[model samples]
Target chain A: MTRILMKGNEAIAEAAIRAGAIYYFAYPITPQNEVGEYMARRLPEVGGVFVQAESEVAVGNMLFGAVASGKRVFTSSSSPGISLMQEAISYMAGARLPVVLINIMRGGPGLGGILPSQADYFQSTKGGGHGDYRVLVLAPSTLQEAVDLTMLAFHLADKYCNPTMVLADGMIGQMMEPVEFPENYVEEPVPPKDWATTGCQGRAPIIIKSLALDPVVLEKNNLVLAEKYKLMKRDEIRFEAYKINPKNRILVVSYGTMARICQTVIDELEQENISVGLLRPITLFPFPAKEILAEAIKPNIESVLTVEMSMGQMVEDVEWAVKDKKPVEFYGRTGGIVPTPEEVKDYIMKILAKETPAVKSWNG
Target chain B: MLTSFPSFDKRVIIFAGAYGSGKTEVAVNYAIGLATSQSQSVSIIDLDIVNPYFRSREAAFELEAQGVHVIMPHNEMCHADLPIILPEIRGEIERSDGKVIVDVGGDDVGARVLSSMVDAFAPKGYEFLIVLNARRPFTSDVAGSLKMMRDIEISSRLKFTGIVSNTHLIGETTTETVTEGYELAVEVGRAAEIPVAFVSVVTEVAQQLDPNVVKVPVFALSRQMLKPWEEKVKAVRGL
Candidate 1:
């Protein structure tokens, strides 16, 4: 394996290619467009299919077409453009198609400014498209994680027969960092085309779609999806805990780029004699709630702060994880703005100062 | 003509223009100028959701290598097409450390998306500059340019801070074309009650034109289509 300096976008694209992804369909949107450009040039070089579809609508359907043919496929886009692909994403989820979608998020309610933003935290983790479905969402903070998670996203989607998303932001997409390419880029064997829409020869043709008219069948399918999501919660939960000593009193929760900032904050706080730790959720969906809860049980911990780029969207999950074991505070800056390490440290200090006497303990 | 507007406290500046109006080229040059002059960190956010060709997002890696943050939606999100607001960008805007340039897509429809974040920006003192290319359709004349500005203002819910007149043809652009565009911007500026902040000229023509022809600031735009020419010139001139 060779270590190369790669932007977050190129890392994901290269990792996907190494993970045996053969079909990529996408429209151009900012921050993440390099992934498409890279795939457009690289996909053909490797005998893979890359289509710059007419629109997001067409690209999503093109994804459906390719995935239904039993080929690993993926697409990428930003906020407003992602809105156009929601219908198709819902269809893919309902159809139980395995596809990897990467969201290099930008700020937006509608065509928001193109600055790096993480306002899509709720959208990505809670299911952006309609339907009683959940996509396996992975949030990567570093270029290496972006590559590793994207490669794993394909495997998870195929193993569970579901759509997976690499929920990243403009910073992650645009940042250049050194990443080691996977060793032995051996293509994974495609699963047997048992359920693909490739024409069934002399047998009943399998139809890949989300339209279920039968009430009984629809209910059964919904139950199956629910069960699978539950299984994912149990088996796929991942997180990175930094400086989680028992003496640590402040727990900071963040994901993606926010987590990187939180790490810097933790480092600064450590130097200032303020005990702080960071719990970064790599998988936003099937979020690392159990891990957070385990950390929250430390009697010495005073409070938990959920830091996000959005105005406290992920704080709900953080509060849920703590379950009143400690007070959870929310601090964030939104609309394509990033908080500095000093600001994050200040926020943590404020929360720590407000802690009740019962919550304060000196285990150290 | 040239006029330099007073700098605001906010770091992010959005340059929005119509399709085929060379907005991206103007934005790229403006960003480079801001970065070089101030020796500060600058980012370019490519918000061009329409017209995939020659978009700022295509220059993400190039800009990143130059140390400018390039924030656009990812390729996969383009497939989902769901309205996904990346809040991480909001975090950056709040940092108050560097200049952030947003190159929005063409047309008022594309510009309308900025309305939702007016609340987010109001307190932060961010400024939105609409780039007007007199050569583009709907902005070919003073009246048409005013209409476009009104529509953009109505959609973005943010008042125009100023105007950057960047009139040019693909390869046929000249100093005269830029001058005429600057004059048109001046007329629109009077009508719209905003200043013509700057006039953009191509790097080649910029050297030939007298700096005093306009009362406003002059920006030198380097075209992506002409990158090889510029590279060759750089090598020859030892720049």
Candidate 2:
């Protein structure tokens, strides 16, 4: 296949199409409007369906209904728009429907700025919608990774019979890069969902519901959902460790576009003979916690730093993973301001400077 | 300095392209190159209302440092996504003294902004060039690019005088990418009855291009639009 330049949002939409996702429901939001725009134009040519619903509220419900018919379906939205769809997202999770959501995040608390941000990390990994459920969250740092993860998201969602999300920042959505789709790739056939609400001509009608009225049944349902999440955790954890070596003293923890920036920081510091490593989490939910801890507990690794475009949301998870075996530090810039590599390098230099005396005390 | 390069000789120059066609990058580089090379006053008007990221105005600091005046929306609404056209844009387009390069937004939706100022352009007789990146999905071929040119012309109420063949895959751009884009641009230009104005290549790739294959003037672009992380290396170098 030929390599072509594509924006992250457009690539994700095309990847979904290639993965046999025939139905798309979405409302337009900046930084990610390209996803819907690409789908609306391309889906029709491939005998697929594209619906511009009245709002995100309606878009989410449309996905819930469409996926119930056992067709591959997905939706894309930015932060606030994703917020509006949380109720439907929760419902889909409860009903155990397989669907894909692409959240090209922007700065947010309310209707935030349209610039790139990773503030939605908590909202995505921790469940934006209420209830005892989780969405399989995948964060991609590049357009190519976005495409690969989007394809994987459909497969994973179907495999687990749950909603999966591609959590990315506006930078990933808007940046242009060279990407190649799998050439005439065929997906492994998934077994037909025996639980789908297909026609009931020869047998009893099937009903899928999230509302377990009885307390005992509700607990059992929640437990079943919990077990599915455990299975995902066991089989689906993904991450990348860049420049991990015994010579490294500082380990940088970051994900999405922020991880790319951290990679640059590591390269810059390596020039100064200051060895630093990076751990980029690809799966945000089953978030490579053991991988982070494994690196943090190494003898030469003095401290771990979590950098992000948000005000240190993922730092909590990083700290939890480290469990104080290595001092975990946090540096962040929120409101769509991405922390520069120079700023991050300086922050790491500060940690190195501060840790010298602490190390001397411990050694003495 | 290279002697043979695309020169915007017209008093008023306008650039429009499909999304990710490298129009804004070309516009910013042209303004800076013109300002740094010549003593003439240069000002770039960022009239992009469609895209929220990678607009020419993002390089205002660098442009101003190079003595090229940068114009866009006012301070408070600078980053707002709303289609806010300032009166100063009209003033800049109407001014007769200096060179004005207008970086219009992408596609027909963005080109509509130019239609609003068709009267201002009529008197100036602007050189409207469609920046074509053949790698982009919409303009990947001669037919598709010609259709985009027609669509933009209809929406902007302005005919393109030339084509700026700017095709690259960012860091992965090769000489072949530039040549392929030039080939597509030439085909589109022949079909549309317009001159293939020039070819734009990233400065590094431009240096490596075989002049025998490319007969037209080349505009070597120092990339102005950069991702946050990519900016760090350039910033540290103090460029």
Candidate 3:
């Protein structure tokens, strides 16, 4: 296969098209508008459809309608824009529609800066819109991984019949990298969905919806959704462990762009005879809680440190996974500022020097 | 000895190309080179309204420290992604100062910002160059590169007099990669009826590049527009 140099946004859009996603509906948003621009130009060549919706609110419903017809559909947007689509996301989840969503996250709360950030961790891993529904979230650290996960998200959504999201920061969306797609690669054949509201031409009418007016039916529907999430947790968890061993004293848990920096930090520390292990979670929703716990409870491990581009969002999950056996600490930079490798190494040095609170607890 | 770029007689230099074609990096290097090479005033105007990251203005501290005046938006609006074109840009272009380097945004959408300053450039006799990177998807071949050149020309309302062969895979660049881009650039320049101005190779690869095949001047580039993690990453990966 011929390798082509592409930006992350364009790569993800192409991967979706190659994965049999023929319909894209989205409004323009930065750090990710390249996906819409590329789609507008390339989709028509493949007999696909691209629509610039009036707003993100409208885009979400458009995806809902398109995916309900049993055709693959996806959309890409940034932070504030993603918030506008949450209502539709929740509705899609409750109705058990298989749709793919990409969140090229920027800084938070309201219309924040257009720099890379991971503040949407809570919104992505947990329920963002409403209720007890979950969106299966995949986070990739490199452009190659971003392309692979984008294609995989479609299959996972169809398999589990739920909404699947690719959570990437703005840096990944903007940076240029060389990547290759399999030539003449065919997608895995998915069974025809009998539940689609296609039409009642000859057989009975099929109703695909979220409205369960009866309490018993609502309870059953919620349980069915809960079972799908449990299956994802059991089967779809993905993570990468680097330099993990019994001699390591500090275990760093990070994901996405932050994890790439931590890998450099770990390599630098190794040259100085300081062994630091890194746990990079590729799946945010089906988080590698068990894997993290196993690494944290090692006899030589001193403390568990979680790093992020936000002010300590995923650290909660790390703390929960460690179960307080090891002192879980957090270091972060928020509001569009990415934490550098030097900063992360210096924080690790402070932990090693017994200057931070983690050492005080260890001594006690 | 390796050949270096001849000093420019034109006061205004503008760089425009497809997105991710190394325009900002080339513009930054050119501004710093002009300031240090000769005892003269130099200014770099960042007119990128398309991308929010990796703009020439991001290297303001380094560029200013090197004695080059950096023109961008003021304090609160500095990092804002909204398109805020500074009014002083036209004044700076019209001043007939020592040297002015304009780093335009990528593609036709970004080149559209240049159309607004057509009158300012008409009086000053500018040297407009298209930075071509064969590694970028849109301009990997001769036809794709020519289409982008025409699109940018039509959008900016300024004809390009030169073509800059700047192709590399960031830290993974090699001498072969530079030569490949130089060959493609020669093809593009021939078809467009423009001169292949020079080939930009990173300092490391430039040292290893054979000077016989490349007849044009060679610009040895030192990466200035690095992300926060790039410093340590280069060290760790030995790039």
lDDT of 1 at B149: 84
Residues A16-86, model 1: lDDT tens digits: 99888989999988778778877976888789988899999998889888999888899998887777888
| lDDT value for model 3 | 0.89
> Tens-digit lDDT track for model 1 on B1-239?
33233344566788776654667877776676676667678877666655433466545555666666777677645323334456655666666478877777666766776776677566767667778777653577888888888888887788988898877654566777778888898898999888887777776876666566677667666664322112222221100
Off by over 4 Å in 3: A358-364, B1-3, B232-239
TM-score of every model versus the real structure: 0.61, 0.96, 0.96
> Which candidate number would show the highest lDDT if scored against the true structure?
3
Q: Over the stretch B67-90, how does candidate 3's per-residue lDDT look in tens digits?
A: 999999898677777788998999
DockQ for the candidates, in order: 0.02, 0.55, 0.43
lDDT of 2 by residue, A152-268 (tens): 999988998899999999989989999999987777676678888789999999887788899999899889899999998998999998999989999888998889989988998
Candidates 1 and 3 compared by DockQ, better number: 3
Give each model's clash number.
Answer: 58, 0, 0
Off by over 4 Å in 1: A186-191, A355-364, B1-239
Chain B TM-score, structure 1: 0.84
Pairs clashing within candidate 2: none
lDDT of 3 by residue, A1-364 (tens): 6566788999999999888889999999888999999999889989999999999999999999999999999999999999999999999999999999999999887998788899999999898998889999999998989999999999999998999999999989988888888677666776569888788899998877788899999999999999999999999999999899999999999999999889889999999999999999999999899999999999999999899988788888888899989988788887788888998998999988877763222212
